[model samples]
Structure formats: C-alpha cells, structure tokens
Target: MRDDSTRNTIIFVVCSLALLLLYQVFILEPAAQRRQAEAARKPAAASNTTAGPVAGTLPGVAAPAQVRVVTRQEAAAASPRVTIDTPALQGSISLKGARFDDLFLKQYRETVDPNSPPVELLRPEGARHAWFAEFGWTGANVPGLPNANTLWTVTQGSTLTPTAPLSLQYVSPAGLTFTRQIAIDARFMFTVTDTVANTGAAPVSLAPYASVQRQGAPAHVGHSQIVHEGAIGWLGDELRLIKYSKWAKDGGMELPSRGGWTGITDMYWLAALIPSQSENVRGAFRVTKAGETNIFEANYVGALRQIPVGKQVTETTRFFAGAKTVPVLKGYEKQFDVPNLNWAVDWGRLRLLTQPIFSFLEFIYRHVGNFGLAILGLTVVVRLLFFPLANKQYESMTKMKKLQPQMEELRARFKEDPAKQQQEIMALYQREKVNPIAGCLPLLLQIPVFFALYKVLSVTIEMRHAPFMGWIKDLSARDPTTIWNLFGLIPWNPASTPLIGQILDTTLHLGVLPLAYGFTMWLTTAMSPPVGDPMQQRIFKLMPLLFMFIMAPFAVGLLIYWTWSNVLTILQQYVIMRRLKVDNPVDQFIARFTGKSRAA
Candidate 1:
C-alpha cells in the first residue's frame, strides 16, 4: 500500500509538470506571439473606418463618408488645436469637436530607452486606436446643443497649461450661447466648467453629460487579470469593473450614481469622467458596434436644469487622464472628492494586505534608490516580523531532527504492526514535546503575504521599468538572461529556434536567479529532517527543482524576494539547529566545502 501511494504521488507530480509545460507551449506562448504580431501588423495611418459616434451622440447619427485616414500629426494639424502644456501633460485639445484627443504623459515613456516617445494617453480621432474624453450638454426638446460633431471656437487662452485655463465658445442659431472653461492641475486632473447663457427668449432644459470613449479595443486586450483593463466606475459607493469581452457580451449596464465617476482604464493609464458630487447622475458602460468596430464608452449625465430666458447656469465635470500613480490618485480622491478613485489600481480582494505591502515597498524604494533592493529590504522586514513564530517552529524542527534515530527504530520494530508503530511515534512525539504540524505554521502564514507582494509587483507602474543588478533591466519582467543560450553570451536567440522555440525559451531556459533560488530552496529543505518513508523523502528532494521550473517565468523581483527569503530561512534554521545540538545538513555542507570537521 505504501509503495502504491508513493507511486501515485510521483505520478501526480509528473502529470502536473507535464500539463504546465503543455499549457505554456500551446496556450500562453501562442497567445503572446499572436498579440505581438497583431500589434506589428497595425498600420501607422488610421483606417478608413471612423471611431465616431461616441457617448452623448444622438441615435442613428451617421459617421462621415470621406473616411479620413490620417497620421496623428495630420489629424492634429487638420483642425485648429489649443496647445495643452503642463508638468504632467503635453498635447493639444482639438478645436473641431472640443475633444481632448491628443494627449501624452510627460513623465512615462514607451520604453526604458531615453529616446523613446512619452506615453501617449489620448490620440487623434483619425489615428489608429483613437481615444479621448468628450463632454457636452444634452438637452430635452433642444436641437443643436453642441453634440460631438459640433465645432467650437476657442475664446480666450492660446495654450492650456497648469497655470492657465482655456475657454471655448459655441453659439447656436437658436440664440443660446455655450461657454466651456477647461482647467488642469499640476497632476492628472482636468476640471471643465461649462456655462450656458440663455440669450433666446425660450427656456432650455439641459443635462450635463460627459463620456470617455475608446475606439475598438486595445491592441493587446485581456493582457492582465491583476490590473483592470476595461470599463471601471464607482457608483453609489460601489466600485465596478467590466472587461471589454464582458461588455461586448452583456451589451450595456447602468447604475445610478450620485457624485461619482466612470471611465476607461488601461494597465497604468486612466481617462475617467467625474460628475458633480451633489448632482444625481446615471452612469452607463455601453458598447456600440459600427461595422466591424466596437466603440466602448463610459458616460454619465447629470440632472437637467432649466435655463431661464436671461439667466445662465453653470455645470462642472472633471476628467482624469494620466498614469495611475498612487500619490496622484490619492491626491485626486482627497482634493476633488472622487469616490474610491484608488480602485483604479485594482487592489483585488486582498487590498488590506496589498495596500500596506505596496506602501512599505514604495517607502523602502524611495530611500534605497533601487527597486530590487527595496524588495530585498521588504523581505527582511517581513522575516523579522515573523521571527518569533518562525523561531518556535524551527526549534520544534530541531527537536524532531534529534528524534530521527528513535523514529527509525520504531518503524523497524513495528514493521509488521503498523498501528503499534503509529502509537510509538505519538508517544515519542509527546516525550519530545514536538508538534508535528509546527513546521507548516510559518509557510501557511506567508501565503497571504506572498500573494500580496505579487499583487503589488504586478500592478504598480513604478515597477514596470525598474532595474536590478547586472543583466536585469526590468524587474517586472522575467529574467532575460537564460542558460539555454549561455546567458546571452552566444550569438543565438532561443526564441527564434525552429519548432519548439517558445516552449524551450519560456520554460526550459533557466536563468541565474532561478538557479540561485533552487539552490537556496534545496539547502533549506536539506536542513530539515528527512521523511520517515524513503519514497516520500525522494519526492521531497525533488521539490526545489520542481518549484524552480514553476517559478522560472515569474517576475525577477518576485524571484529575488523569494530567493532572499529562502536564504534567510536557511540561516535561521542553521542557527536553531546549532544551538540545539541537532544534526543538520548545514554543518555537513560547510565541513565538506572546507574539507574540515565541523567541530574543528
């Protein structure tokens, strides 16, 4: 029976590893290559198709026929644009439709390369994958109320900057004058104050509406589950996120929100429409199909106000278009009363653990000037925090190691009497005052912390292009140096190898860091007492190798933290074993390496 159980355990482990390899080769690698290929195939010029008819657009509105496919430069130059220059933003607001379609984040870049272009937040309407924020007034029984197609005239500012706000004006033939004041802060928030003056005799009822619309889906959609990449909103104090696929399947969804915001979010960038806190609004996440394109929109409309014959009322709405940095989001949440704006970070259900871990990591990184070092420091802090519990657990393990001889004897003596062997083992344990489960306590406790750190590393933009020691340019990415190509020393690309290229490069391409992790894990396992069953001991011996393969594709920062943690655990166990005078693998390893007796 024991032999059969051991065989089954080995079989299960082998099958799991096989399935993992298959999944990486057949699913993950293929999907990644396909997405990259698609991005590469996209033309620089916008397609003949238009990304028009966004939110606040009238039903049955027809897109223009000429299908103006132009470059971003042509799109920006085709219409007069107001320059948007700020510490955090650089772009132009198109005067044609008063749309913030040409915007770029000044801080972040497309790559770590200094010459790479800054991150483009919003692109021109006629450019590929066009995205922008458009706000307008929708009035009942009122025509020509400045819809998306309406061209507005810039009134005051030549340039929109943090210190200066731009004003735009549009006068309807019916005698109502619409004025828009666009103001931006030092960070990512943009506040638009719209005022409509009733110059005509008749009163006009208008509902202030805003929408953040993205044409088609992202080039690389459904890329991450850890970070939200679709329609997100906070309505009625409840935060919501709907993926692009979900939106397409569900058609549309709406929630009544008072004083909240809704928008489209990328992995690190966001464009949200914030309605006034006092105004009751209806938020909707809608999808519209035009030909082969799907237009995604997050829009909200405030309560309609009746503008009297000679009186004008003002309505204020906010727009956020920038990186989803922690400080900026929190600042906006506090200053503008944006509800649950931090949800933009996608903290997951473990926000309680993830938030603190992220804060601690960021705090350490600021002082250390290295994100990789910060992760190492964070691991040390975590280890110290759990030192007391781990000490007790290691001490118990030491005691168990001391009883190995007696346990072996009992097993031999009760070879035919299994029940008596169990009884003897329990008696021996009670005599030694060793809890059999103590070794598992620290591991169980670290699971949540491990997942929290993973969440932090996966979602935070600060770690996106962070670097570590030699050969590690981006800690957020997998180790680029793989042993299969002699750590990139050889003039060979494992990924370009025919047939099994991706599978070999992704799974079997061992990195220096992963090898270090495996070694530390092996040492930590070696210091522990061997299992009573020889087969079980053999299976346990393979755990380090199995885990090294499993974690090979994980982020380098996580691998660094985990490897450091293993080293710390081994050191702690060594100390406990030495103090308790228990036989351990550390002494043997040291003596073997030094060619001297451990006592000497």
Candidate 2:
C-alpha cells in the first residue's frame, strides 16, 4: 500500500511537471516570440505617425485631422512654456493649450545606473509616443473660449515651484477672460484651477474637462499578464480597469459617477486625474487610430455651469502623475478622499493575503533598512506563525518513518493478499497512532502565502531595483550570475553563444540562490520518510533538482524567501526529530562530520 501510494504520487508529480514544461515551451514561449516578431515588423515610420484629431477633444468636441510629427526638442521649442521645477519633478507646461506636456521624474531614473537619464513621463505633443494632460473649458456654441491653438500669456510667476505657483490668462476675442492657476506639491500632485469671466453682456454655458492623451501606443504593451498596463480608475461604486488590448477591442467605456478618478497606468507609473470630489462627472476611456498607431485617451467632463455676465466661475481639478508608491497613494487617497487609489497597484486576486504580506514586509524593511533582511525577517515570522502546524506535521512524518520497516514487511507479506495488507496497515497505524496525511497540511497551507509573496515582489514599485547582499543588485529581477560561465569567473557570456546559450541563460542558469534552495529542499526531503518503491524514491530524489531549474527564472527575492523558509523548516524538523528520538539525516550528517554518535 505504501509502495503504491508513493508510486502514484511520483507519477503524478512527474506528469504535472512534464505538462507544465511542455505547455510553457510550446504555447507560452512561441506566443511571446510571435508577439516580439509582430512588434519588430512594425514600420520605423510608425513612431513618427503624427496623425491627429488630438486637441479640443472631449465627449462631444471636434478633433483635428492631422498634426505634424517632430522631435521633443523641436516640439518644446515650438511652444511657449511655463517652467516647472520642483524637488521631485522637472517639467514645462505648454502655453499653447495650457497642457501639462513635458515632464521628467527627478527622483527616478531610466535604469539602475545613477548616471542614466531621469524617467520621462510626459513628452511634447508632436513627439513620438506623446503623452500629456490637457484641460480646458468646453462651451456650447461659444466660439472664442480658448481652443487648442489659443496661446495663453503667463500673468504670474515665471518658474512654478512648491512655494510659488503660476497663473496663465487668455482673453478670447468675444470679451471673455480665462485664467488658469497651476500649482504643484513636493511630490506628484498638481492642482489646476480655471476661472472664466464673461465680460460680454450675455451669459455662456460652459463645462470643465480634463484629458490625458497619448498619441501612439507604447513601444511595448501587455508584455506580461502579470502587470496591468492600461486604463484604470476608482468609479463611485467600485474600481474599473481595462487593459490596452481590451480597451481597443471593446470600442470604449463610459461611466457616470459623482466623484472619482480616471487615468492611464503602466506597471510602475501612473498618470491619473482626480476631479472635484463633490461634483458629478462623466468619465470615459477611448482609443482612436492614426494609420497603424493607436491613440489612447482617458478623460472626464464636469456638469455644465452657467456663467452670468460680468461674473466668473472657477473649477479646480487635481492630477497625480508619478510612481505607484503605496504610502504616497494612500496619503493622497486619505487627504483628498480618493477611494482605493492604491488599488492602482495590481494586488491581484489574493488581496486578502498579498496586502498584509506587503504591509508586513514593508514594516520589516523600514526597521531593517534592507529588503533582503526584510525578506529573511518575514520568513522567520511566517515560520513562527505556522510552527504549531508544522510541528504536528513533522511529528507525524517521524512516526511514519519509524513505522516504515513494519509497513514494508506487511506489504511484502500480503503482496498477493491486497485486502489483508491494507487491513494490517490500518491496524498498525491505529496501534502506533500514526497519520499518513497530516504531514501534507503545512504544504497545503503554503500555496496562498507563496503566491502572495510572488505578487508583492513582482508588482510593487518599491521592490524594483531594491538590492540585497553580494551579487544581488536587484531583488525584483532574477539572479544574474549563471553557472554556465562559472558565475563570471570564466569571463564569458552565455548570451553570446546562441540557441543553447539562450536556454542556459534563462532555463538552466543554476544560480546560487536556486542551488541553495535546491539543497535545502533535498535536505528536507531526505529527513522525511523514504518512499517504499525504489523507482519512486529515485525520481523523488531528483525532484529538488528539477524544481531548482523550474524556479531559476523567478525573482531573487522570492528565491531567498523560499530558501530561508526551507532552512527554518529543517531546524524545526531536526528539533522535532530529536524530541521523538527518531533518526534524521541532519544528525547523521553532523555525527559523521564531528565523529559523534548519531541519534537512535
């Protein structure tokens, strides 16, 4: 019975792994390659596709036919601008449309290298992949109300700063004066207030509108399903999200809510608009096409307001364009009553687990000042939390190991009498108070915890570029040192070699973390009861090596967590085995190393 169960478990593990490997190699990898090939096939001229219909666009506003493409420098040179120089941001506001068109995140860089250029968020309008925020008054049948080409004159400060804000004024030909005051905080929030005074003898109907538009799709979109890249928002009742591919395929979406936020989001960055929390607004996400390029837009239109003659109406809206940091998002969410803004971070379906894990990890990180140490701290916490369950599990396994010889004898004696063999095994189990399945409880409970950790390590911007100790510069990335080049001692790159090289770099890298995890896995398995079937035992012995290869490409942070967990499990099992007076490989190995007597 023991032999059959072990054989069945071995077969199951082997089949599952084989199926997963085959599916990944044939389906997922080929699909990724085809996507790369399709992206490569796009014309270089597509980057220059300045096909327009960009400006003066709202739910009902008309769009222009075409706009010329130009370099970011040339586009910036073409427009008069108000300089924005904040501690965390450096950008310029284009006066032509009063658009937030040029922005660079001063606190972040394009790469881990300190010398790399700062992260460019909003490029100029005529530039390739131009993304910017536009705000204006949409009037009904009122012509000279500051359209796209209406350039504004700066009436206030020259350089916009946290201490000093700037205001721009535009007077239409029809006796209307428009004033826009733009202010920014030390972080990423920007406040824009628009006041229009009807100087003529007649009243006008006008509504405020804000739009975040991108001329073309990002160079790479939907690279991974793990990260959400597209339109996301917190509508009145719930959060709404649409990926880029689905956003284009589904035509578009419209939602009417009292107070909410809407924007386009990438993995680590976000450009969102927060409308007046007390006003009703119509929010929309739209996609248009220019030649082969797809243009994306997310905007909201406020309710129409009646402006009396000689009187002015003011509307204020806030914008958030920066990294998806949890504390920052939560701060804004609380200060402005924005619900679930941190939901912008893809917490996945495991929010119940992932959120708490990330919070705990962040807390530990704050105390330790290193993400690697935080991960180790988390592992220890998790182990302690599950110590009682794990103790019972290891105790059951120890009892099973003590009864293994008797079970084998019963199985061999009743080889021809299967029913009798089962009966004897059950009687023996009753006599010895052994449970064969209690050992699986801890493993069964670990799946959710493991997946939650994976989500935290993968999606959070805080984990990006976080370094661990020696040779681990980025916790969010896979281990860089590969065994193929003897961990850089050979001074050869596997990537330079071609087919097998690519495989070695990705699939079979066998880095130190993965190897350490594999060793711990083997040690834990060795301390457990041996499988009765020889073939099953041999395959089980190789399972750790197989898993090492399987886990080689995951984030180094996850590998560290798992390896440390395994070490803790080993210690727990050793202690339990010592209390039970059961023989374990740890004591045997220690005995051999130190020439001491082994545990009986």
RMSD of each: 3.3, 2.4
| Clash pairs (backbone) in predicted model 2 | none
The lDDT for every candidate, in the order shown, is: 0.81, 0.84
TM-score of 1: 0.92
Off by over 4 Å in 1: 1-52, 55-70, 496-498
**Hey, what RMSD does candidate 1 come out at?**
3.3
**TM-score for each of the candidates:** 0.92, 0.94
| Tens digit of per-residue lDDT, candidate 1, span 221-293 | 7455456688998987899889887887887688798888899998888998888888899988888875456
Clashing pairs in 1: none
Best by TM-score: 2
Worst 10 residues of 1 by lDDT: 58-67
